[model samples]
Target: MRADRLVSLVLLLRQHGRLSATALARELEVSTRTVLRDIEALSAAGVPVYAERGRHGGFELLPGFRTELTGLNPDEALALLVAGSRRGAQAFGLGSALASAMLKVVDALPESYRDTAAGAAERLLIDPETDLLSRRLVDEEVPDAIAAEVLRAVFAGHKLRIHYAAVDQTPMWRTVDPIGLVTIRDRGYLLATKSGADRTYRLSRILAAKELPEPAQRPDRVDLDRAWQERSTRFRTGGDQVTVLVRVNPGRREDLLGTALAVRAEEPDADGWLRMEVSFQDSRHAKWALWQLSMDAEALAPQWLRDFLRNRATAIATRYGVSS
Candidate 1:
């Protein structure tokens, strides 16, 4: 680990030309003391590292010094840079490493493709904090230590003990055999099992974690995609599923389908509107999702859904009908 940190420190100085010990410490996620010791070690090992003492002083690599890295073609360079810009990897505690690796990648690229690829990457945004609709992305935090432990268990086939807080439930500790880790839309999930029963835990809800010495009680080899698909199918079917028939504006059909868990049936109406039967996790989920379309989509069946929406509309009218 120290070796990696030292290499990263050198790369940072080379790329930036000069950096203060404090800045190096922050970038490397270590203390200034460690950075100073690393600098001494590098210098002792004949690295061309030197310190300047003036007010604008810092550490710098010798002029013309460069480290060689694997050469990447244009497309390959661009892809790596784009991936490094995303926050998804942060959920697994690899944010800093990704950043450092990106730096090395850019520096290692051929001069012809380096600037152009980086410039193209800058114009392409993966997951902005807020989209054009002004919706903030939901990104949860996971402590670096906890994520590291989880990753260790998952990769090494070791059982893990975790203190988890499920939604609306008290925190409890459980020993699970971690199967794999999954990340979607910036949220991370641990696909594991307890007592041989399938279990899924949100990485954000892990309060603490411990790696166990015992080998994990999972299959020697797992097809993550198949496992995830099976779990998703079971979850969609076994939950308190509610179905509703709706007529929606043709233009907003995609919007309606996007919010629903699945569409059971769909057909075009005589009036050119879209008639569809959709499934939601529950009645409340159905109501919340349909309400978003407002006048554009109308729930036509499941009389209770219509009644609930009507009541909701009445309440909204009551609150805003009177202009203060």
Candidate 2:
């Protein structure tokens, strides 16, 4: 099992630019030694997976060695393209050299497969009005098996072993319970209650992870749905560095509190508004938050929040002749 996994790990990293041995172990559910042995196997097999030794080190394939993708049906071809389109979708098993390899596979296919591939091409475009990315990248795979395991580890009382990364982070291993997966199509993500506060992590950002059963699972009131929603609204387009502590209107407090955008920062007000603080990095994002509030919410703050809103009101008056 260990030796077989090493080969797969090598292929995984070779195909996907880099991964730490620890990350490989998490994905393979083995010890670090096992992953190392696997790497040794690859080196012996003429697959050049080199180790990057340092704070930034991880395994990467030797350049100029490209594997040819062969034996794909039309469904496989279509699946490859569509999968490549999604963030982190490439991990599903389409090798790294996707396009050129795909073309090669298509050329070798029976005429029927070619006809189907053409039909798929004509049938639909993934996103007609999608914003064109300056640089498009193929996402690696996140098998449903792995996804399901994460949920089990976090919500189902298990610990996770992961190959994880962060800004300036060297990919390393982690043992975290699957908290809950935060679905961001562009990137695979999760929210784990690691280090006390629940941390949201992009899945691909995590090189690998797995769950454990011992130490027991911690209890929480993490409504995955609510958390996901909260995460979505926590950012402002152009916002000031203020945490807008607001009391929702008496009539709308419950409804507002239920919303994903409503960050539950405090208690309900005597007037029935739920009091909470909304943090912003700058005035632009702050104004954007205020704009979202429309009439249902008000900013109760460090004076600046109110002043900003007032100025916004004045600007509105000056622009459209509404009120001063």
Full-model lDDT for every candidate: 0.90, 0.62
- TM for candidate 2 is 0.35
Q: lDDT tens digits, residues 74-137, model 1?
A: 8888899998999999889888778878988887766678778899998898888999999997
lDDT of 2 by residue, 21-92 (tens): 788788667888877877787788888778889987888988755553457766887776564443333332
- How accurate locally is residue 90 in candidate 1, as Cα lDDT from 0 to 100? 89
TM-score of each: 0.87, 0.35
Off by over 4 Å in 1: 22-26, 29-34, 53-56, 107-120, 322-324
Residue-level lDDT for 233 in candidate 2: 57
The C-alpha local distance difference test score for the whole of candidate 1 amounts to 0.90
